[model samples]
Target: MDTTNSPSSTDTDDEPRWKIVGPGLLVAATGVGAADLIATLIAGSRYGYTLLWCAILGCIMKIVLVEGAGRWTLATGHTIFEGWSSLGRWTHWYFGPYIVIWGFVYGSAAMAGTGLALAALLGGLSVAWWGILSALLGLTLVWFGHYGLFEKVITAMVALMFVSMVTAAAIAVPNVPDLLRGLVPTIPDGSVVYLLSVAGGVGGTITVAAYGYWLREKGWNTPRFMRVMRIDNRMAYVITGIFVSATLIVGAELFHAADIAVSTGDQGMVDVAEVLRDRYGDIYGTLFLVGFWAAAMSSLLGVWHGVSLMFADFATELRGLPGDHPDAQAGGRYFRAYLLWLTFPPITIIFWGEPVWLILAYGVLGAVFMPFMAVTLLWLLNTSRVPDRWRNRWWTNVALALIALAFAALAVTEIQKAVSGVL
Candidate 1:
């Protein structure tokens, strides 16, 4: 199996095993943050096995979006940021401010989530200290570890999360009949929040844009790698789909039976763990908590690495510099600057509460990003920029259009909730 993403490969007899798995795993793992888990768990608990179809749909949408990202990279030999830039300066105009602001706000939140999960698993430290430590650890690893090293770490963490979480689900022994019923794909009454969450939040974010950067790092630079890239992206999301489905199954079987009410936010996973402990035992609950920590940490590391690369590219391009120029690649001035922005400035938010207005802005920016990425890819891939063979198929365009609309609707509701203090 050749791990090289270049078009020079000629080996015809290899197994093509692990080489097929690329940065798609990192993207899928990064996208399935703590928030996604809680959403799935809540969906299952509130309406047992009813909305499983949303999770499946979410996976399909991700595959389409990610493949678009990878296709643009391989076809054009340009990053997604560069592809977006081909449209005009306005693409950078929107991305520049959004990346900086999003990083500052999300950095604190992600580190804090990782810390909370670690605090639950390890007994002595407060969440604040744990969060600070987690942030530093992520910074250290990515600061030294380039793309390959970063991919290995995220893959291992995601694997640990899959094992423990799925094991817990297996122990729960969900009813096959009810699980099958979830395939019908209907939204139940009063399940608006759950529906939006499962449909919109299943393994998605601005990090999807990072797919190109990771492909670049993986050395997938030409059209011949297209088949391998597609396989990698599909396999990664399928694994993500399984992990999410297992979470839903556990939620339906365990919490639905007990009538457990899950709260909103990352802490909801902890709440579920407690319920599991009461019914099953400490070992089961502890194992699940460990899995939860792995998920949170994987997300934290991925954002720390991927978004820093994005911000670095954004800053360099704003200065009219090239990507391979000295200051745009890993550990360069722009990259480290964004790294500091992601790791340090956000600590202030940890001390002083996150400002309501800034939080609102974060929600607004985040809401727009998915649609922005999808719509931009639709434009980039459809034009003469890519060869006809690499251009989106009819079904691909339809899927992307639906994804854009779905994300737009979700964004509107998010803004409304932020305005109403309901999010």
Candidate 2:
């Protein structure tokens, strides 16, 4: 029986909706790392509520993108890669190099991100060592395909992050009027990059592409669960918006109002934690650091698991395994290999800084990926690959086109930034 359209035993018809945290939440939370928070914080510190609207728009963009991914999975029992493969050889050409390169470089960045937080929180080890430890810990947790346990741990961590960051925002008492004005969407002087970052960075990156794999992991495999999935995606990104906005509020109060400047990158996050301590006392700073660590750790764990599933599936497909093959899912041979790829070799990048060529490759390839995903989704959802009834609506098409255009613009800036950083 094709249960795609039926609310069968596996569809959670008996479970209360409120208790079910869908796969969307996992993917959404995974994308909000230390870097994203600092981006929004710097924007707020520099321009007050000026970029708040960008945060909101970024969430909506992700919601649309993720929904398209999930819908493709349920409507067809095929994964995103399978759909990409159907599009033509070009997808294979693009995705093959992109995923391999993206994973190699991203693994390094993810570790450093988490390491910075831990070093800030504990103070016993250097960032590089803490980053290595973070990888080993992550590997141990997901080495054997403990999906249920992994999901639970992520949920707990997300809760920790939400409580701490939101509480800090509350302490800062965000200005009601300024926040309202931000919704009007006017550009301030020299705020283009900040505007684009906030608009494009929130709620996603390659992890957004992992949404379908996450759906399979959560057992929401068919169209009967699509309604629930949309609800979950919407709720998750909305909270993501608030979570990001709260950080901006904190930055506005702590740095902008006080006229203090913030440094760049993840270290900026550490620096702010100290400022948080100086202003709000030891306990508050400690709590905020925990939140920062949770954000970094959650992102690390997510890519480790979710992207591994994605890579494993791609590998399995290459060897002609069935779509439902065990090897294509978590704990498979390829899955473990990719997990190692995400864990071990990148430790060297932590010890030694990223090479300039690697940065440029990472930047250019990484920049193009967002547009690749958007344009591809627009293609897949509109084509005969999807059931006619399940195709993209006009609004969805318009939204994705705008998303593609927006990401393309950002891609130019990212490539230039990468190039200039090296030069």
Candidate 3:
């Protein structure tokens, strides 16, 4: 993109070396929680190695999505929210309520997910209490800590998740020949839903847009850091691919081989832990639970920090405050307000589970977001809103278009399923 508008280039030009990892890792780790892991495992267990290409495709598409977000920030010196605001007043109308509602539902879901992992580890506590504890812990960390501390803690959790999941994959003894065959992209019969779900759901989410905000938090606010951001984005998703693929291997080796069906929802991961315990030993089972908790908690931490930034920024703009205002950034009043919104009210869901109507609404809202992200990002990166050099190239447009189509289809299906469930 155009480096001229990048305010930080003058200061960062002499910096010695670029870090291989950054906010990208946090974004990737946070996006793939227990539900994602379980989804990948379910795909593997049901279809063996048939859906490996789908997961890889998901990672590639996310790289494009995140790169677009980071590019906008670096080239134009605006957050993604600001870019959306530039589009029209309607952007505000859409996002203002969307963030509020999405946060309320997602908070409980995220906490309950982490709680499931914690309950698996500490049977003395019920899942509801564990979920509440997880939400409180995430709230405490984000409310008290700044970006540096948040980034470091998320990095540590990513390490724990990587090591444990990969080790478990290795123990599963994947069939090399079958894995190689999966790369060729053959969909087994009756696997259309699983195929779309894996391809579209792997690594893309609301958090992909958070990449830019996280980059700002990491002191990479200029085009000079563009190369580093790309490397960071790719590396993070590469690790995501490895982590996801390993879970698939676990599913293939354990559930597929044994012809066992995993449970549904967050508890499914707990079932996997039990499977690990029975097939391997207690230590392996405990290790899997640790990894599960890392994935869940990292997601809780990531959204608590990242989306809160988005929310705070939205609130600031809504109030006509400057983007750089303290209240719009980390550990500020607006930020903490959104953080609490994401941590507390959802606890009710933990105790009673999501009400039927609320669950349906959340499903409908969640279904549309990825497609919204893909479409908006495609628009944002293509126009003069971004620097000419950073505009979406032909390949980038192609990828995003495909992502939009894929996610739109998935959204339709999800909405149908949600409605059907309610009826």
**What digit string (tens of lDDT, one per residue) describes model 1 on residues 57-157?**
88988888888898889888878888888999898778887887899998998888888898988969988789889999999998888788888888889
Q: Which runs of model 1 end up more than 4 angstroms from their true locations? A: 1-13
lDDT of 1 at 296: 88
Candidate 3 lDDT over residue span 265-347, tens digit each: 98888888888888889999899899999999999999999999999999998888888999888888999999989988887
Model 1 quality (TM-score): 0.95
Lowest summed lDDT over 10 consecutive residues: which window, candidate 3?
A: 1-10
Off by over 4 Å in 3: 1-18
Alpha-carbon TM-score of each model against the true structure = 0.95, 0.96, 0.94
What clash pairs does model 2 have?
none
Let me know the TM-score candidate 2 reaches against the reference structure.
Answer: 0.96
Candidate 2, which segments miss by more than 4 Å at Cα?
Answer: 1-13
Q: For residues 51-98, could you state the per-residue lDDT of candidate 2 as single tens digits?
A: 888889899899989989988998898999999888887888778777
Q: What is the C-alpha local distance difference test score of candidate 2?
A: 0.85
Predicted candidate 3: what Cα RMSD to the true structure? Answer: 2.8
